[model samples]
Target: MTKYVSCRHHSQSARSEHQGAVMEALEGGRENAIYRKGELVSRPASHWTMTVHQLLQHLHSHGFAACPKAVSIEGGKELLTFVEGETYNYPLEGPIGSLMALKSAAKLLRRFHDASESFLKLNTQDVHHWMLPSRSPKEVICHGDFMPYNVALEGDVVVGVFDFDTAHPAPRIWDIAFSVYGWAPFKTDEDDKMGTLEEQIRRAKIFCDAYGCTRLEREELVEVMTLRLTALVDHMRSMAANGDAQFQANMEDCHHTAYLQDIEYINKHHQAITLGVLGEIKF
Candidate 1:
């Protein structure tokens, strides 16, 4: 049996250059470790710890108030204030609330992306780039995992965002694709608005319009969505093979399985969905 250490029992030790093991005690089965030094959470030599710290520092500097404040604990574990909000999983009873939530999320992403552009150019010491995609000239910071489950909503408004383990620098389009792929859900109708593809298309338009994306960019939605979906499938497979139970369960589910299997469907109907989203915009 795995030994469990209480959060209080863990002692703060000098920051080491070793990858710390995950503590299975945290809720949501978070892979965390205790660390000393820095008032914010720091995993001495862990890639995720470095990435999360970078993201938090960037957001805090830019006055992005939606992320958790990292706190350093006695042990190697870093404590992030728990965000309080419900996951925007099931569709809202009314379309207005859902629209509001998507709009808010887009605006937040826009702000984060814009701020990250400047940060990327700055040289910081002891920074280890982890999971960062090849940096393109047009690349900004990408929230590698910009799914609905990572976004917290309060009464139809996006309150906070969590999970920056995959944060990296990539093209602005990558960020847009990641968000839309999950929010619009290219292949599966699981997130279809009120149980219909038509409604899903309508909501997709609302999401794109709020983000102020150009028509050409919207047209490439299908292509970008496919790339994002394919990347996600591979990511899930990797996580499962590595013994991530949550990802394994998601991969085994029929809905998620269809989401992975039906990539061809989205590729085939990309134009139609693009037109539907474009038509909804009054410009």
Candidate 2:
């Protein structure tokens, strides 16, 4: 038998040191999620939570205010300051679909990578965390799951990023690749609501320009796109194999196959993508 706990089921008593804040359920966290009293968001703590909290604290100290601030652990859930804005999910369209938005997303990621350099050695791999530690040579803590859906918007401006469960040590290119893949969204023409292949390529370059990637980093862009998503496919397989219920369902729905398809597509057009984003890949 399984026990279920509602977000509202636990709170401080009237006479206790802490007072209850009403928890309103948020729409999109993969884990159980609720926002307390309009100021704090709460989610079940995983082995990675403590480490993620530490990283968030470090980022806050550095002047990047785009991510959540860790608050406290209460009722077995991790409490965090709620970032106010909108998250554009898959099939990204609207202001975020524009070239300006793409540039904003890229610059934001650059800011994250710049601020993240200090935490490279701090993330000593914990034995119980589910995600893998990155092994890149020019590593910093990459926001491993950066996507349009996870980005927060303030009107037409890209203001913040959320969902840090997958943050880990990796090269700046690791996050930059996904920033392009998710925003310009490097997908088949049918799935790309943003624009034509030529337009997508054009916009991808704008993103790279805004990110200020060095010649060598631009040289490695397409390859890192392949590496990043292929690792996602492998991670999905491992999760399904390890009996993760949601991953099992996603595998059944051919989610890994879809990722593999995109990986193949990215590899197939590797040269084009390279040229499209960087004009010419420098060795």
Candidate 3:
């Protein structure tokens, strides 16, 4: 029989000495361990169980304040202070708010990537090696799922990023691609519930401009975004077929349809989107 632990029932007294805040692990699903305080922090078991504490320790050593400070817990669960904020889901009703959120996401990515660069010199192990077979080389730590849902917003502004399960060492472009695919509004007209293709492209440009990405980076960004989007759709399909409830709900929500639509949109307007992002760069 499988012994189940209630993350929610876990006491606050088990928290590590490094953390001065109250924290608790939420119930259900080992994919990520959730905590509540001011905001919810979702730390993936795959990454958090292996290296998140060390990663957080390293970040603190480096003087970074944006990431969650890891704390020890009973039953080997990790604890982190919840970052209070709103989540960006559905559509942004206004144009200005949409643009601002995208720009904010880009800035956040810049900070994450800059911080990740420091890890390159460290002797970190590749977590992916223990997973399925993949040709991608493990490099700097990549926030695998840097999408709107994983980010927390306050007053239409991105304030904190919560989920870090997909966090692993991979090419930095992979992280950028992940963000662009989602925040760039890389969805089809059918998928877009509140805006047009033109509006999405405009927002994408704003994000790219805010990041100060180079022309080469823009081109690579487009390519990687396309590849990652395709791979993600395939991965979700496989998971849904395997009776994964979350993946099932995601698919039932017409996610695959939206993904296909986005692919169609990309094929039809790759040149335009590429030029739009490149044009946004000042240098």
Top candidate (lDDT): 2
Q: Regarding lDDT, does 2 or 3 come out ahead?
A: 2
Task: Write one digit per residue (lDDT tens) for candidate 1, span 208-245.
Answer: 77777777768777777778667767766777799977
For model 2 the TM-score comes to 0.85
lDDT by residue for model 3 (1-283), tens: 0111122222233332226766554443343445555444444344345465566567667765566666664454555666455554434444224767788878887777677667645854444232222226654667677766666566767766654545667676777776776676676543344456666667677787787777777787777777777877787788889997777877877767676776777767787777777774222
* TM-scores for every predicted model: 0.72, 0.85, 0.74
Q: How far is candidate 2 from the true structure (C-alpha RMSD, Å)?
A: 6.4
Q: In model 2, how many backbone clashes occur?
A: 0
| lDDT, residue 103, model 1 | 86
Candidate number achieving the greatest TM-score relative to the actual structure: 2
User: Could you tell me which 10 consecutive residues in candidate 2 have the lowest summed lDDT?
Assistant: 1-10
Q: Is candidate 1 or candidate 3 better by TM-score?
A: 3
Model 2, span 181-228: residue lDDT tens = 767667753454456657767777888899898878878988988888
* Residue ranges of candidate 3 with Cα displaced over 4 Å: 1-44, 94-96, 124-139, 154-156, 189-194, 241-243, 252-254, 280-283
